[model samples]
Target: MDNTAKSAAILNGRLAEETTRRFTERTFRIFNDADHLSHLASKWKNVAADKAQGHMFEQLETIKFNYDALRKDSELFAKTTASMVLGTDPVDIIISDGKKTLREVQAKSCNHAAASTFALSDKKYAEMMRLSPSDQHAEIEKLLKQRIAAGTLKAGDYEQTLRNLKKDLQYDNVSSGGTTYQQATEATNQSVADRVADEFRVKSALTDMHESGKRAGNMGAAVAGGISAISEGFALFKGEKELGEVTVNIVLASAKGYATGYAVTALSKGVTHTASYYLGTGVASTLARSNAPVAIASGVVNASKSMIAFMQGEIDAEQLSDEISHTAITSTASFYYGAVGQAIIPIPVVGALVGAGVGYFIGNMIHQSGLLALGDSAVVKAAKAHRKQVEAMCLAAIPEIQRHRHEMEQMLSQHFAERKAHFTDAFSAMDAALYEWEPDNFMTGLTVINDQFGGVLPFKNFSEFDAFMKSDEALEF
Candidate 1:
């Protein structure tokens, strides 16, 4: 292929791969949201249903905010956690952007019939009144530690709460809004019914974000695929392919691009997500949200191709091994390059793409150079193998060839002796007939000659032969 064709193929492949990765990543996040919601429901089972649901919405909104912030600045890290401190801490959720506290949310759910208002729980007020200041501080710290041990809070949460406690235990914010419940149901069901609409809104917004991301990825991939097809068409045309052939080539290329894109993207996402358990969400999110997945997908694709080639006998085991090693090393380089690129450019996908592309090129170049260096040795090894094979074949044929030669010699010697005896006998008979005028001897010589000439004589005896020779037919001959 020419440079133009090569470039087109590369572009098409990269675009397809990237498009697929983005789509799959978005899809994964959508499912992740569902899982998160389920976990939250289970975790907050002891809390009032309405309160738990409202808190869930609050947490999701915070998550949505963090996602938006990260898009604007990758370096900015934001997260939300449900506050688990005991004794009416007033803070239902904590929000941070990794550097400092952004907000401490006190979420309250109330139906329209009850009131569009909220206040600190009675328990909190009582504690504030009953406990001395120092004792209150100590008790709050003790509760924070207990919450941490019970898996209700993290170390970060513990630290943030302690910091707040040291600063006079102030509640930052309260989240209460007019809900959709117009008529008051039973007191128990009123809050739940009122917040139902709000819960839907929050969930829908998050879902829409995921869907939007997926659609964008799909659209980008489609554009890339179209461009790829056009490039391929031009390449095929330059090579003087027929119109039909060019069309077929373009279609096949497109189909393959899409198939590979989806397959590799899904595989890479699955691997990354599974690894996230060990890597932590921050590190995992960085990988998933960036083009590092592309590097992983690329390696997987190359490895798959190598395995297929080996199975089809197009590559030997040694070559397959080399390819696997090359893919692993190149992929690692690509991933690191992509990560660095993300850091430097911090423009989401673009930076990662540029870095990964450069890394792949460099890695491939090194591999190719190594192959070239070993080319002579490989050729010499092949030549030696071929020579040995030829020698073995010759050795195998020697015994059979000797057997055939011996048989031919025996047959030829026996035939020569038999011919010599027959010739001597015929000549003696002829000489006797010619010198001594013996008719019987002449007849015998003629018979021998006839037999040697394949027995074409018509007469069976001398009397019949003499009668025919004296007839008019004999005179005509």
Candidate 2:
């Protein structure tokens, strides 16, 4: 295929991918929320359960962020397990680039602002040594302060420096194998300190991720803009669009997409919130936990887009109506299918996502088929053919029209310059005659004036000049 066709195909594919991903992502989130509700109902009173819930939330967030990064940005590959075996792995998540490990992430949902109060232990200290140097230093400082407060070490006994403390504790750089009594004690202290630092890091990461996720409209806008830019870039490469047009299109598309996404998200949330007040928490929560909101939001956004396109004269009224109807039907189908999917699959979130996806796919296929049938109609075909003919004729005449315009401009400019020069010369001569009061100067002025009239002056002497002035053939006053 040509670049034009290829670029169009890729753009369409991207649009489809975005729609599917949005639906499925929203579906999964709803189910995840439902799971949280179930937990709250059953184990709300248990402190341990609350802790477990927090941990699970952190883990899920980490997995989701990594998964999105991989899918959207094509970043490093992450090996994530839904279930983790306790004591089997020290890290909560491992990230690689297909060839080598990039990072070992330890997820924690603890409050970062709180001071570490866990007692120092030998095994913990050893683990602290495995962390980066900055982390190790920070942990050691905290531990030393704790020990000093407890009166285990005199304030003057050791300098607060990491090097001094390590030396005094008989600490070695080794992470594994043979441990002395002093080393073990120091290691134990370091481990507890390490926990404090690790929690801080995890919490910091989670906070940033949460903040980013909360700006869903901005993210959606960016994604849409980026996709448009890529598509336009392809067109630029194919000489189908100029740089200025592409830039403007990208900016406008981003702004429009952002407004639509933001409005839809806000409106959907508002509707759900308002419903909760009237329907009670239980009913509202159930409604909030379903795919209906996502479907409705998507449909509204799509319909708005169609309306905009129609207003811009990009589509006819019939096409606009069809698009709105298609969006409504598809959205309705997906919402109901999601419920059926959950019932059939008996999985927490997987079934709903799969079912909604299937529903959307079927709806889209039918919509496209209907559009194709409409396009093949006689009136539509004739309109298209007429448009093509007009476009071809315009293209053919453009060069000739431009050529004529350029020639006319040049001719007008030349004529203007010539006339201006003649007027300037005549005026200057007349001024010189008036100032000098001499026959030679007057004659020069008259000669210049005669030249202006194509040398048509009829007299050379005073008598002929008087007769010429008196005669009807003379120039009118």
Strongest candidate by TM-score: 1
Each model's lDDT comes to: 0.50, 0.48
Instruction: Give residue 257's lDDT in candidate 1 (0 to 100).
Output: 48
- Candidate 2 residues 1-477, lDDT tens each? 121221222222223323333333332332333333233334423345324433333333333343344234333433333333343555544555557766554332222211211212223232221211222335546665666677653333322222232211111221112112222222223343244334433333333223323344565567668878899999999999999999998898677556545545544544444454366445645665674555666666677777888999998987776667666666666667767877899875667766776666665555555553323333455678899999999999999999999999999999878878977887787788778765555666677767767875555545666777788884864
Candidate 2 at residue 93, lDDT? 44
For every model in order, what is the number of clashing pairs? 0, 5
RMSD after CA superposition, every candidate? 18.4, 25.5
lDDT of 2 at 112: 23
Write down the TM-score of every candidate: 0.41, 0.33
lDDT of 1 by residue, 302-338 (tens): 6787799899999888777666666766676666776
Q: List ranges where model 1 is wrong by over 4 Å.
A: 1-239, 312-319, 340-350, 371-477
